[model samples]
Target: MSLHIVGGLLIKRFGKTGIRSVNLLRFRLAQEFLLCFILTKNTFGKIINKTMSKKPSRFHVDESDLWCKNQCGFYGNTAWKGYCSVCYKSLTNRQQSSSHRVHQHASVEKAVSQRQATPELSYSKFADKRRQQSKTNPVKSLFKSTKKDKSEVDKTSSKGHHHLKSEFGAFLESLSRPIYEDISKRVQNFLSKFKLLPVNSTVETWSDAVQDFYQIITEHINVDPIYQTLEETAVENLQDQLEMYLMNRLYNVVFCPPNSNDEQEDLSLQKRIRSLHWVTIQQLEANVNDQDIGVRIALDKSIADIIELDTKTLPKDKLACIVESSRKIFDAFRLSNEKSEVDGGPQSVASADDFLPLFIFIILKANPPRLKSNINYITRFASPSRLNSGEGGYFFTNMCCVVDFIEKLNAESLNLSEEEFDSYMSGRTTAEGVNTVYVCDGLRLIHENNGMIRRLKERQEKYANSVLNLEHKLSEFREQFDEQINQLVLRAPLTLKPKRGKADIDLDHDIPHSLPSPILPQQISNSQI
Candidate 1:
């Protein structure tokens, strides 16, 4: 029966007892209002306003209030009235107290009683308790530790990170220049490191691109394998541009950096390094089978030369041009691998385009004491192998994910306290070194949204470790070289043992040249489509 009907029936039963009946109706109405109010209000509330009534926190409410309000079966028995569903009928007898009052008027009296307290805790005592509690609670401790560490990384990455270095900042915004000029500097850098090649693909000036292509083809004939394989006059329409690009790459390592610590230099360097690896694997033509040690050495020298950017042999104005030339070679190698990918996934292809920055990749592959900051960078930012598929066909790959992770981690590092930050960076424990005994493990928590990427990264960790070993060896070699000679004397005493080779120039001898490979706009059109 409805409450109103029940009340009316009660009133009819107690017809002569008007005052008591009216009191009963008022009590019942008040109870109903309280119940509805309790249902609508949030189960938990901050102490927003001091209650005139002695209302208990909902925590003390019969546990049903703790159950989600949206669940329709909200109810409690006499012993657990106002409790959550789980605790309602299951409440122990101790939960019920006869002193509990239903009326707000009675609640006000209890509120006054609540103001009295028997105990007071000092600040130091509370702090110690909190510390103890945190130490014991793994979940809370982990959350706090993560937040603290993340904050520190964020603070540093936001402003003071290694990308602030100058050479890096300039590389990002490369200016466009004459194509022939760029090629000259590229050839110059290549010759300085690798033994001299007599002729690279020659460029020709023509009224139109086709004529230019014809002239380029005429120059590289009989020199490169590509030309030798083709019917001499039949492939005459092909051009020298492709040959020119291929020759430049085979000769040297080129590096073009960006103008942004803001763009993240350490990150860019790592990406470039990854690209360099892919280039090594994907770009070397099918025919030229060179030893890895020789190629790696050449790459190391090229990268060192590029980084030095010295202008004694080349004009100072040409320094930027030299770097730009290297960038082109970098781009050319990238493009060639791109071409290789389109050319029927040829088994003959050796060097592939790098997805990472070339110089950075070369440096890392050289395997020396990596720029500590760089290692720190890769550790934090570089995406593992999880970021790619065969779409670009391993062109860009997953290096950028590593870079992005570092950036995110940088943002996250801001929460670490000074001591925590110090420990993270140095892996040092204390004056006694007790805490430092364990290998400091850093975490890279990728966004959950990239679950596939996360799994991919897990697999790449091993390969990355291999690359790190290579880097360490390179670092050791550089250190040994540094110990042998000072910066000013690049060469060791020539008088000690070595003799220079004398070149015998023969006018009648057939000097080999690169074969012509054409870059017809039409070839790409059919392939790209």
Candidate 2:
């Protein structure tokens, strides 16, 4: 029943009651309202509990539905694209294996077919088969012989070392003057265009100008009568020579042009590398024999060679130095490996991973002057074919990568603590109480000291030799002087002449007795005696 209707009926039935009876009726109504509220709350709560119990929970998924679609009897995961992780991995692996097997079977069949197609021969038929093969493969045989002859010719040519004669003899004889003049004219024209407004110049423009210049020169060489008689390699060498000549002339203007920031970058990179001088081979995890004297010498030589890069006038020579330095690093690694092998360790060749860190270390130590400018110059002016492949390109790329790495290097990159790195960079004592000196600084100090000692020793030896030589010369001179004096004495011997007295005067020859005769005061003389 509704609470309002019940309360209204109770109020009507108790309408004639007194204040006490009315108060009791009101109390009964309050109790009835309280009881209704409690019963309704209990019923609603039960209903809600039932509804919630009937609803499915996210955690209680059905097992059959959760099973892998492949029926592998394992639970599936959304992460695995509805397949079990194990089954998914197995499926992928099986697919890969099957594909690999198919490829292998195909390759095997192809090999078998090739083998079956070729006829097997005994010694008896070998000569006949060879004759038939030669008859059938005349061009191939010719190519083989040609290749052999070419290789032999290359070997012979390389054996005869002539700095300028062998490579550019023809050019130097006839083509050099005209070619140089043309290159000079072209360079002059090109420079005229950008010499004044260098800020407007771009690398692309410069590259295009160079490329065009090269093309023109190449055409000129090709059409020249002298070039026709030259061998293909000679022609190529001539072209290379011309390129070098042209680049050397252009290097001053094109390399690190006034508007470019190559110099600034070089200085920045140098400073960064100097800061990272404390990065040891161990920190870089470079595979080098730091303790081996030979390896250390090689690395030091490489550092010196890399430093010489700035001094090289030609890009080729600079590239040669880079290649030499890289080779030295490789040799160092090889030496290390050999030493390790001698110590009963496994032997291995140096790989790119091993090369990079050591190269980085070398750069840090060498800190070549105008490094960025050199790199930029080479990249800009070097033959594309040279820089795209071969040792030059590879090592130059590594050098570039090393520079970049140094630029971006930090404590995290070196796997060092920030505090330690800071201490090293600041040249301060670390927590370990060890002051960090850069590798270059320590090496330079050692080198200077050793050089000083060597020079001092040489000076000492030279001074000793000089003193002995002087003493020997002095002895010879003294003996000569003594002999001359003896000869003089012998030639004009000293004779004792009799002392002439006044009484022994020859009156006619020794004295003019008749010239004048003055009378002496004999009395004064007798008194003085």
Q: Pick by TM-score: which candidate is best?
A: 2
* Local accuracy of candidate 2 as per-residue lDDT tens digits, 26-135: 67878987988797997777667655643232112243544456886555443234454346556756888899999999999999997889665577588887876555
Give the poorly placed runs of model 2, Cα more than 4 Å off: 1-204, 215-229, 428-529
Worst 10 residues of 2 by lDDT: 136-145
What C-alpha lDDT, on a 0 to 100 scale, does residue 196 get in candidate 1? 25
lDDT of 2: 0.67
The local distance difference test score of model 1 is 0.35
Cα displacement (angstroms), candidate 1, residue 46, comes to 40
Candidate lDDT (C-alpha), each: 0.35, 0.67
The stretch of ten residues in a row with the least summed lDDT in candidate 1 is 198-207
